[model samples]
Target: MITVFAEAGYEVDRHFDDGVVMLGFDIDPTRRSQAVMEAREHRAEARSMAELLTPSSVAVIGASREWGTVGHALLEHLIDGGFTGTVYAVNPEAFELHGIISHASLTEVPEQVDLAVIAVPHEQVDAVVDDCARAGVRGLLVATAGYADDGGDGLARQRALVHKARAHGMRVVGPASLGLVNTDPAVRLNASMAPGLPERGALSLFSQSAGLGVLLYASARRRAGSACPR
Candidate 1:
């Protein structure tokens, strides 16, 4: 009997040959077993999310030139953090922002984009998601807050946004998220709107409450500053 299992987007086939279990393909048994364990541990949805967190290139779909907006802050953070990967700023009305070339849409950007950070108004999120999907973006970080957080009609729109992302095989981080940051020096990704960057350390923090997370980062920065010799 041959049994096939799909896990974390990977398909594994096991065959019972003469009372012995064997993998259908010519793969190292040890490696195959490890893969099976990993697959079982993570689901398909989570696998895509993992990719979203470590994208090499990111596009800011609602990037803005205005200083006070979330889109502007996020773009500034990425630049100040020294993110080594490519960054694209998308806005139909803008030609340039902070010296970076701004495209009218995601599709207009010539390079491949791995992730899209949407900071547009809630009403515009769905259309932007559609644009991102058409542009082949695999991950989405929706920083816009008006959706489900607003209740009623907003919830329905949020649902539609998620449905569209899933249909295109893309992973969404949040519709009302504080954003994300990776302290790795090589990656140097800071996708959040936090006041400042926290010092790199062994410990990593994940907070559901955006306010608390911002405060935590601020405290970390203070602690790091305090520890430094004057």
Candidate 2:
């Protein structure tokens, strides 16, 4: 390590005391402060990951009663996958879905939502993200498309969504994501539109395209399965 540092323009020194060895580097104050900031950001990112992967509770913003819809499939994925956490369904028009009581909005739910899955339309996405931020949702998984994929205006829309989530100290997965699935036995979470939660394995896959993700997951399952959370 001392040799590597010396090659990288750092003043490296070695010291010994009582048979103990230690290496030191002469670091500039500006670089030291920058390193501190980078460490802080990495810690924050890890916290967000923990919240997103192992939330105590979750809310599906656009959960639906209709069987063929994306919202319906996402809700079913969570329930059928044997997720142990509290699941809240949010739909303005319906009072109940799959026997669980549904709230009119994110703020209407009584419990603290650790993760919010936004499956609403592109036009309604910005408002829904704002509501989730205001309600203090720790992490977000946006399944809504049309932003960034549509080319011109979508770029700006996607940028805004990310900026808002960061401003609130929240982590956001995607503006055009398929969903997320964790096959861990302790926390079985499938917040995506994929057909089934693959069996627990060491493989972890992430992608922006739902179609390709579904294909990859199927292939992974054929070989013993994987954990894919986009």
Candidate 3:
């Protein structure tokens, strides 16, 4: 299947058995090589999407104390989902969240951070991206909105975001993304605002709309007999 995409001139990256595929196109021949390099990083390695999917350690850049905020909810869900890896919280003003010590910034974290789930506001995303790139973080899951979806300047910002991350050989999920979940028993990473974990299975879901993603996940969970908890 990946070959099909490559044959058709699309830069296909990943095609998993569960029906998940990642593909893109490079209009410029000069940038194709760089795109391939980026694809290799996204394939799986120390600095790649593997970390985002099955990271050794994750730092929630916008971790928060407020119960209703996306940052707090994602952190709670990630911990509650039983990810067997190190979790760090980053909040400049707070020293701790959910019982773990918090750092003032991504760079402040003592050890390397493979993936960073950013839930900060749209205005501060560039600065966070800079820190993530400087820290050599592998993948980024940006749950904040106001990017390409907003059109005009927002679209330009979104384009720049990807360009910047790609230049650093880092992968980004979304500028207005909901997040990702891997129900694999060995790596149960849930870095989103979705409440309760869906039962582990073969199904892999993706959606452009967060509202619909929630609906689909909820429905899937109910069908699997592991209904989402309120």
Candidate 4:
């Protein structure tokens, strides 16, 4: 897979119009698995995010008891996913969410925080980002949509945020991402639709379209079920 990516990366470098520049994964396989492992660890470190910033802790900036809200779903899903992290639901004028204590601000949290999941409205996102950065949050996942994808004013504001986040050394994944899933650690970080991924296996799937990804997952499951293994 890495070799395929390397070829794709070189191809990307040949043209300036290739959408996003592709960076090849560089890992020395000659030193055995150690080099590969270290490379992965470094990538993991840059993306350590939620786990790195919060140390078994989480702060949801838009938490609510209301059903079906992003905040609600995130909290519920994290619990169901067996996240051992402590979750702090932050909402001013609200004391609790689903029976757990809720803080009014990230600064109110007693100890250092590692992650902040933002699901607030687009207008409130900048403030949330500023708050998280001030709180020294290591990782932030923004679940709120309606950014530049909507065009017009939204695009300008989203661009401002892109600059702000880069300045703060804070990592922001999406204003439009479907989130991510790493079942290896029993972790499902994205709040998007779960594709009913396999719990244990060496299987890995990547797709640009969410619908196609799920369809392929179903096909793979069917093939694996009916075919005989060597």
Candidate 5:
């Protein structure tokens, strides 16, 4: 099957199995180099779309105000980082978790969510992913552990969870990631283990750990602050 986009041009890549054929696109330019560049651009665009439309976001599937809990710090990090979007915390057992409106399930969020950060139990990860998919969430950042990292059935479960996410057209970032931060809105949405927020400027840093990201931000902030000596 061939699908042509108005501005992007035609599909040139394909995969076939049984009676199903997958389609790809060709970048126009009539040159190999330009074609590759265009193809890369298309791939990037697809990625950016996935990230941007991640719908509503939450810190933990069962967050609370308890110390050392995902619930207590999730909202705090968002507020500290200045996340100005729709943020919710999911904890069915609790009426309100950490002063934020809590929902028993992602379905109760009342709005379409493109992404969710699941800190639920390992066993609950799959069900949570299923719920997110059913709720139309396209991106998932799972911070749960107890998977293959231990080297056993845990690994198998983790792999299976990833496959389940893929089947649902959802992108999973990590099974053991610290989380992420968005500098555009001056927000840090990752785990509290992060260092600290960076100074405001044209540059942004993407780090693997909240601590590291914050550290980098601090460095940048210091540098920026120092550059303008009053």
Candidate 6:
């Protein structure tokens, strides 16, 4: 006689004719199976991140009209960088910015937002994240600071923000990041807060320090001289 029990392709227990019973010997297979699942999950997440990086549409939350501000600079960069995708500026106080209509909130936007760039204060990060989750945003780029790097309660806040974003199946880029940029002609997304746009090139850069990255980008632009050879 033989008895077997399985779950989702995993064998839980087995019994054979010689009165032999396998108790928890399935641990190895279970671990291996879990590892496989996790690998697949990581692959899926990588694909999702790629899509997010090249979204067809983006919404900049906490956009502002005031010059020199992070929110304003991000919006300006996106526009000046020649991003072909739809761009939405969200600000409750302003109806328009840089000639584009500004929605009062993410929920108020009529179309779906592929990625949401948040520039609000750290204190308001939670609420904005909640709004983005409710709006079904696929990716988040948080430009606000005052978390983790600030230490103490700030670290907890950053952890909570990540947890909430994960719970809603959304990916977060940063709590105090300089944001990202893509040089693809079809999707020219310059979401960073750099002083100037870097010339388009094949080289993609990732920097650990925001200040250093901006300086490097500026230097590259100077060397490239207005246009980067394709």
Using lDDT as the measure, the top candidate is 2
Using TM-score as the measure, the top candidate is: 2
The digit string of per-residue lDDT tens for model 1 on 28-57 reads 445556777777667775676567667799
- Ranking by lDDT, best first? 2, 6, 3, 1, 4, 5
Model 4 RMSD in Å is 11.6
lDDT for each residue of candidate 2 in 1-230, tens digit (9 for 90 to 100):
66656655556678998898888865764564566667878997777677788988989999998988888988988988888899999999999997799999998999899999988998998899889989989889988888888898999989988998889988899887787788777888988777677777777786667678778877887776344332
Could you estimate the TM-score for every candidate? Answer: 0.78, 0.80, 0.76, 0.65, 0.69, 0.79
The better-scoring model by lDDT among 1 and 5 is 1
* Candidate 6, 1-230: lDDT as tens digits: 22232432355555465786645435455765676678879999779868777988889998999998889988999888888899999999999998899999999998999999999999788999999989989899999998888989889998999999999999888888898888777888888786445667766666767778767776667778454322
Candidate achieving higher lDDT, 1 or 2: 2
lDDT of 3 by residue, 82-199 (tens): 8778899999999889989999998889999988999999899999999999998978999888987898999999999999999998889998787888877787888877766678
Clashing pairs in 2: none
Query: Where is the poorest 10-residue window by lDDT in model 6?
Result: 1-10
- Per-model C-alpha lDDT, please? 0.79, 0.83, 0.82, 0.65, 0.64, 0.82
Looking at candidate 1, the ten consecutive residues that score lowest on lDDT are 1-10
Residue 215, candidate 5: alpha-carbon lDDT: 65
Q: Please identify model 2 stretches exceeding 4 Å from their true place.
A: 1-43, 208-212, 225-230
Worst 10 residues of 4 by lDDT: 7-16
What TM-score quantifies how close candidate 2 is to the native fold? 0.80
TM-score-based ranking, best first?
2, 6, 1, 3, 5, 4
